[model samples]
Target: MRDASSGNALSDTMEVNDETQAPGASWLPRGDDWVLQLSGAWRGQRAALPELPAQDFNGAVAVDAEALRSWDAGLAAQLWQQLDPLARRSVTLDLQGLPQGLQEVLALALHDAPPTEEAAVGPAHGPLERLGERTKTWWADHRKTLTFVGEVLLSMGRWVRGKSDMRTSDLMWQIEQTGPRSLPIVSLVCFLVGLIVAYMGAAQLQRFGAQNFIADLVTVGVVREVAALLVGIVLAGRVGAAFAAQIGSMRANEEVDALTTLGVNPFDFLVLPRVLALLIVGPMLTAFGAAVGMAVGWLVAVGIYGVTPLEYVYASVESLTLPHVVVGLIKGTVYAVLVALAGCLQGMAAGRSAQAVGDATTASVVQAIVWIVVAASVLTVVFQRLDF
Candidate 1:
């Protein structure tokens, strides 16, 4: 067939490469010039240009896209792949024969301009600007934390009113996990700590012939500070990480979303029970750990040291006052709240992946530990100020 526009006929039959199915390309001879013909809808993931022929074009080539109905970034990418090398090798590209939009796009793709000065150096920020940016990030993070805390408080209020989705069974299970099951480890740790305290105190007190004072040291130290602090650290590692892992896995599986779709508040169903369980069980554990530690201290004092059992018992009883026990219980309560908050916050904010769940679990443990320590320090300072 003759070309009607310029009366020039295609002399050679060019077939589209089989690899490129729909949006294909072929080199057609139009008079003395070679026209690269592009046809079909050059869009979507499957659209691609044909493979480059082994025969190199020494002369300029014209792009004939009159048959192309539509195009997208995929076509632009393909055109760049096929035409960039030829242009780099000194072959001129006649984009005028292509669509206006395609021609303009190709111009940008084929250009070899150097980077502008602003782009090369980038925007400079002073120390004040950097500080402002950091402050903004800090504010954003703390705002999210405060919002989560407020939501948790509201959930607790709802539970108190008996209008929440929190289950009695879930609370009992969490209590069992954080309480009785944790006793062996807590007992072992507190026993070892008491042994060390009693041994060290006896070693120093023997020089002064005041072996009876070892009872005072063990009782005051363990009940007022050591037992509560150790229990908090233990639970931060044990229970806090477990909460994060459980909730994060639920988040990854879209179970949290499913709960929300069912008009259930995840805070009520998931977080409140864990927090309440810890709140109820933590003080009990702290008191138990303190009693265990004091008993071990008594054994060490009366067994190894020459202090009489009656004298050691009398000293320990004198040191174990109401204020000391109250302080330890209060610290345990605060640590429990912090642990629950850290674990639930990280789990709820977790991303939807296995790695993300693992990361959230790790972060929850670290955050719980840090919060426990900070709260301990603050409580210590306050207690000291009050002369408790």
Candidate 2:
């Protein structure tokens, strides 16, 4: 920002070989850009420059044909040839994307001549400033649409803390609605998952004389990954879709509006109980699924390896640590929040149309599953780094 030298123009006193030289070896003005001359110099130099002025780019692009009458076509190319990418980067920044004020300045300059060095800064601010301000206001207005989230969670805490008029019946109803109703599918899928994983582990470890470790392998792998994932998939389709559908149905019927008319908070009465219920049931179902998976795996292990049931159980238990179990529970809890939040948010935001309700339900399942997988993978990486 300060002056490069307090004195005069620079002088290249050293006599370097002229033939071994760069094409456009001219010094830029101290802070200015792309204002090069054909005569190369510091001060005392015979420079053969290839650079062009910053202000003449568009003028060069589709210029007046009459302006070229004084010179041949070869002269125009020699005078204003296409720049290399690096030079184009610098040159276009000053010329091609000219602001309105800069465009006016440039137009006026064409009527007269190239701008004097002092007039190079043609405009102060560009159009992006107003665009930025509008973007800020747009974000602020949309943020209010999501204010119901915090209130929903607060109402959940109240229900958890107190035993009164706090939707305990609804909580049980939801557990019945989501977890109990999903038992058949959950059981079947977990069983298949267990069978598949156990078969794979056994086949590989058997080749290495580590067949007995199959129980341990199945135990750790199920608890850490498959169990939590099974619970999450069920929650995404079962509990999540249900939340979206219920709230969306209420929205369609204007029951949520009726609650506001009666001075009963919609978030507390509707979303709170559902969210709290899912959080409570998610960890329980995950543990239940993990137990079932391990049971199925043990059956296969005992039957195939001729290992005793007692030995398989002992080996599986011995192979696992408290940390692995804790990690699975933690993952389940995280998935519960994401699934419930996604479903409730989509449902509450859902349009009044029946199709909108279905859309919300579908979106909730997809988003919950995606976010759950991402969170689980990140947690897995973090846990591996922890080396526990």
Candidate 3:
């Protein structure tokens, strides 16, 4: 071959590496600087470059732009696997004249930023800027989370109102279960209490030559304190535990989610009934406990102390006032609401886990006890100021 500008021979050859060659083929070259391409073998093979023709016009070998493009594209495809991403990227950018796709890929490589690696061992101040930025952003980023505290307060309100509207099933159950069923125990305990008080009082009174006054002392103490405090304590355990268990179970089963999906108010559906029921049952139970306690005192006085029934009745009439009964009932009702509210609130606040439920239950019991003690003390002070 010779260039028209100047007569000269040209040489070019295509060679394939053994790894890139066709199956079961041997490579051989047959030409001067240009040889017939062998199928495979890198030992004596290399792709020939475009030969310099006799003239600088270079007519020795024809170059196909499309062929070079195809070759470049193939090389680019393997870039990612063969080189570090940035290195591959640099290569790609250097060869960006290949195609639109290659250009985009190269641009992506150059512009792409790696996530800053969190170094287990690095410069101490490397993270200082990020931490400072976050601290600066903390208020803005966490505004919603902080505002959610207000939402929790709102939740408490909704819970309180919901409790106020509870269905009577639990409340009625408590009354029927706590009061009616507890009557025998109350009566027995009250009687023994009365007997003990009478004995204790009479022993002292007899020393003072006023044994007949034992009935008055037992009647007054039982009515003024024991009935109210005992009823509140019993309700704290029974009703408080029930409220926690009920609400906690619903939370565990995703009943709260069901309520959300159904667009039903969970507070209205769950808490209201219980709250209202307690409002109704509380005073009644207190009265029941008080009556039984008084009867116990009577039995203790007349049977054990040998106090005449007429004398017992007389002292009770004189010493036991209406204020005592009224105060007991009022305290019981208040305590009932406090305990129920605490239990339900804690339960509803529980997370969706067994441990959460247990935590809620424990918190509910503790809160109920605290509320009861505080309420009792407050009521005592208030009543002492007003009635005593």
Candidate 4:
């Protein structure tokens, strides 16, 4: 072989021509120079480069990409892997035949030539530093939650003015989900709690020959606190998790982004319906739970404790005021709003991954329950001060 332009005879030339081979680069020894020939369509995952030989070649390397029909980032990556090692060994590289774009990409890829070194590991933060970091994170989260709540309130205002984009059918469906479908669990848990309260109260009252007062204990407790609290906790785990998982999955799939692209407000279309539905249904569920709870108390008082049914009913009714019922319903409504907000916030902030959806669902349930408990405590204190 000979160089046509230089008219120089080329001896000891090594030719690597394999037509059936996959897209790759091959190095051939020719005197003091090594010709790195890249062939076939070097595109995407299909571009395969062979492993470099273990033996060191102390010579110049010339890249020959004239046989390349097409190329992409994969081709650049393959070339970089080969060229990086050669450059480490101080071998000169001639990227003459490669496309200008590919040459630019390769140059940019390996511009920061750092000699490989062991990864440095830092010491863990002290307790005070960790606490400060946590406090900062909590404050940031609180601000985000407040902003989300404000957006939801604004969306509700839009709904009130009939300017919201949320569909009526979606709202109705949400109501149905949070309302009637929740009755069975609420009834069961409230009834059990009422029975437990009655039994415990009766045991103490019987010792003092004041068993008749069991009705007062059961009724006041169930109506004023237990029923609403139990319902809130139940919905926090059940309905709150559902809301988070649903919206988080939508976020993971970019459906929420699609809604934004279509000029739809996610707070109006998604969050508002859920919040309103839970708010409207919370009192209804609480009332149902309270009634079932009271009925269980009545059964315990009349059947086991030997109290007359009429006397039991009279005592229970007399112990409960309109204010007690109002307070419990108010708590239920507040808890519902908190649960919806927590779930929606977690869902909206979810990362784009399957694991993120699961994390959001778990966080939503936990946050909803914590908020419910905190709100319950505050409401109790306020109601007590007002003597409700």
Estimated TM-score for each candidate: 0.69, 0.61, 0.55, 0.69
lDDT (CA) per prediction: 0.83, 0.67, 0.58, 0.83
> What TM-score number comes out for model 1?
0.69
The residue ranges of model 4 lying beyond 4 angstroms of the native Cα positions read 1-131
Candidate 4, 140: how far from true, in Å? 1.3
Number of backbone collisions per candidate: 0, 1, 8, 0
On the 0 to 100 scale, the lDDT of residue 376 in model 2 is: 88
Model 4: colliding residue pairs:
none
Q: Cα deviation of 145 in candidate 4 (Å)?
A: 0.8
Per-residue CA lDDT of candidate 3, range 226-246, in tens?
766666666667677777777
**Which scores better on lDDT, 2 or 3?**
2
Q: What order do you get sorting by lDDT, best first?
A: 1, 4, 2, 3
lDDT of 1 by residue, 1-388 (tens): 3356334322221234323335767877655456789877666757456665543444566788877767887788788778766655546569987778878888866664222322222223677765665666568778989999999999999998989999999999999998999899889999998889889988999999989899999999999898998899888888999999999999989999999999999999999999999999999989998998899999989999878999999999998899999999999888888898999999998777676789889989999999988899999999999998
As for candidate 2, its clashing pairs are: 40-47
Model 4 Cα RMSD, 1 decimal: 11.6
Task: Check candidate 3 and list the clashing pairs.
Answer: 162-272, 165-272, 165-273, 166-272, 166-273, 166-274, 167-273, 191-296
115 Cα displacement, candidate 1 (Å): 28
Q: What is the C-alpha RMSD of each candidate to the true structure, in Å?
A: 13.3, 19.4, 22.6, 11.6
What tens-digit string does per-residue lDDT give for candidate 4 at 232-316?
9989988999999999999988899999999999999999999999999999898889999899988988899899999998998
